[model samples]
Target: MASALNSKIHAPGNCPGSKADARGGAGWRMDCDPEMHVKMCKKIAQLTKVIYALNTRQDETEAGMEALREAHQEELQQAVAETEARLLQAQGRVGEEEALRQRIQALESALELQKQLTQEALAQSASCRLETQERELRVEAEHAERVLTLSKEMLELKADYEKRLRHLSGHEAPRWDRLTKEGPEPKAEPGCGPEMREVLLEVERLRAENQQLSKDYARKAEELQATYERENEAVRQAMQQSVSEALWQWQEKETDLRKNFQAQEAALQAQVRKLEGDLEHRGRKISDLKKYAQKLKDRIQDLDVQLKEARQENSELKSTAKKLGEKLAIAKDKLMLQECHVTQKTGDMKTERVSENEVLRKENNLEACSLHPQQDQNFAKECPCTKGGTDTQTKKEACIETEYMKQKYEEDLRKIKHQTEEEKKHLKDQLMKRLEDLVKKHTVEIKSVRSSVEAERKRLQKEVEAQLEEVKKKSENEIKQLEEEKAALSVKLQNSLLEVLRLEEFIQQNKACPPRGDEKPQELDYQHCNILETQ
Candidate 1:
């Protein structure tokens, strides 16, 4: 009994005995013989040892379950944190996409504005071209009208001079025929014979003077006709030169304007083409970005699915942990009941000892205690419960790895987005620079064209002015020459008319004389002498 007491005190099961002592009392009395008491003590010690071993196994199971729960909880928290971070990154990417969309809209609006400006400029150029055409037509019409007027004036002058020449020829023909037909006068009465002879001589002299006057008139008329024709030709040539110069200037101006307009149109078309190309490039980039965003969304959805699966797995693990804890509690309760039954049995069997049977029972119980550890080992191996912590750790690692992949993907997407933005900026800058250069080049060309046109116009105007002055001077000189010729012809006509009147007066003064044969002979001699003097 002393040995049994010492064993009981030293056994690992003594921890439960404190509760048992509290329930039963500090000391208990047993009504049994010494041998039965010793046997009961031995059985009690063996049962306590078995109970202690079972308790230790239950504690190890509980500790493993707790660790698994902690590991699973940690893994679940990490998954949740990673998911939140990915969601935040996704939202940031969405914001960047929205900003890119707004920039595209602004670019489209700017392109539209540029198109409108180009159209307006084209319309203005077309209107200006139409106006120039109308002005040219008007000038041509005015020039035609002036030419017609000049031609009509020339025709009228030619008809008037022809009529005057015809009338003068008709009058001179009758006068010449009458003068040639006159012969010697008929014999007159003796008293009027001398007067008649004197009148005949004087009439002959007047006819000769009239013939000279007609020849002078014919020469003057021929000269006047030649001068008029020359002046008309000169006037016509000058008018033609002026008209041709004006037409040529207009043609040059029209051609230059057309060239400028064509060049501008070509430049505008090139600019439009460049803008179109840029727009297409931007559209392609936007499409790529959209595709990338869609890919990101798909990845995010995959992550969400993974997260859900992880959450489901965590819930399943929690349920399993709860089941294990419940099973451990039931086992502990059974062990406690068994310990109670064993204590009751020990109290009852203390006075009825069968030594050999008790010894055998102790051996069996010792063997059961020894076998309990093996059962625990087998359970730990086969149950899959103890591996929960390792599984949770693996799942946590997977979750961390997925989070890192997600972060990498996000970083890659951000890099691509930034690269695309930089490319867009570079393209825009190049386009602006090209457009600015084209504008400056076109402006310089326009300035040079304008200056050349102005200089040409001034030179043409000077040439036209000089030609007009020369024409005026030539016409004035011709008119002055004609006036001088006309004045000389009139002076000669006046002197011939005075000489004819003096011969008529001399014939009248000799009309009173009568003549005999001798007087007649004297008269003939005097007439012959007068004819010789006149000749």
Candidate 2:
């Protein structure tokens, strides 16, 4: 049993006992019957073989089945993987289709939206055009209204102006008074005015545009326009009214002012006329005075010339008187000489008479001598005489002697007396005749010389008077002309003063106020300006 136990233990299939290789002996001693052991070993071997076969078969079948399961699992995995990949591909295709559909839908939606937007834009543009047209109409209406209002106002103003003009036709004190002259002259408008119609048209246009907008829209769109319209109208009306009122007042005042100015100008013109007349009268008076002065000067010159002539005449007369005196002296001397000659001739005649007488006496004496030649008369002569003869003879002798002596004495005395008487008579006759002739000749010559000298003096005096009169007239006329020129200059200076005052008033209109003085501005050129060109 032990061996069976060992054999069984050593057996490959089933073992009951100890194992073969355990104790060691057959190489450990067959511990059981050998045949039995052999049979057992054989049976064990058979069983081992059968077990090996069966195990091999079972292992192979398990391997095959495992391989098949693995293959099937692999197949299943491949199928599952293929299905998953196909399903994923299908899902991807579906997603791609969905994405494409979304893109197409988006494009269609965008096109529809674009069409709608175009339609909306057209509608909005039409609405805006309508609104703009409405605004234009409203603006035109406002402009018409403004024009009508302005026309009405102008008509009223014209009517008022005509009424005032008619009222001015009635009589006042003198149409104007002097007190108005002391007031200021009215001024023209300050600056050059623009066309009122143009400004009104612009304002109407803006107002129309403003009215076109809705109140809410105006707040958004025409806020500036609305404000401008209100302000423009207010300013226009205020300024227009101010200008119109000023114009009205000015027009009303202008009539009286014009009348006053006309009156003042008329008075001034009258004064100027009077002054001119006075000036003319003065000039005439001066001319007459100059003429009278000329006459006086002429008279004085004539007197002077006459005086000089008289002086010359006096000298000539003195010379004539001297000549006459000399002639008288010469006549007197000639008369004296003639008297002497007459006296000498008379004496010579007397001497001749005396000689004749002496001749007679000499004859008588000769006769006596003849008779008494030889007679000696001392004694009485004894003669044969008759008695009468002797006595007569004696007496005759005595008488002869005595008569001779007496005759001689008488001749001498007569001769002397005769010369003296002849001289006296001749002197008296010659003196009287010479005096008469000399007086007559001298009177004629002096009268002729005096007349000629007086005539020459008168002619020279007349020429000198004419020259003096011309000089005096010229001097008087120059003085009168100078006076007239001075008067004219004074009038011109007054005109200049008026012109300066007007100019000052005009300039002061631009200033803060007017100055009351006649001051003027002055400028001085301190530098000598020259332009020199150099080439």
**Candidate 1 — which pairs collide?**
none
Error of 2 at 317 (Å): 2.1
The root-mean-square deviation over C-alpha atoms between each candidate and the true structure, in angstroms, is: 29.0, 99.7
What is the Cα-based lDDT of residue 526 in candidate 1? 54
What tens digits encode model 2's per-residue C-alpha lDDT throughout 1-535?
2344344343333312233422322232243224433443443344345445545555555565566556656755765686677568667756865775576467546545644654454355346434533543454355435434433444454466446445543333232343245355423234412433444465566456434422333243233334434544454445445444544543444444445445544554554455445445544544454455444444444444444544544454455445544643453344334333433443444455557657755765666666664453311242223334543553455345434533653464366448646855775586567557755765675566556655655665566457446645654564465356445534644453463354335324423331111111000010001000100
Evaluate residue 174 in candidate 2 and report its C-alpha lDDT on the 0 to 100 scale.
39
Using lDDT as the measure, the top candidate is 1
TM-score of each: 0.33, 0.24
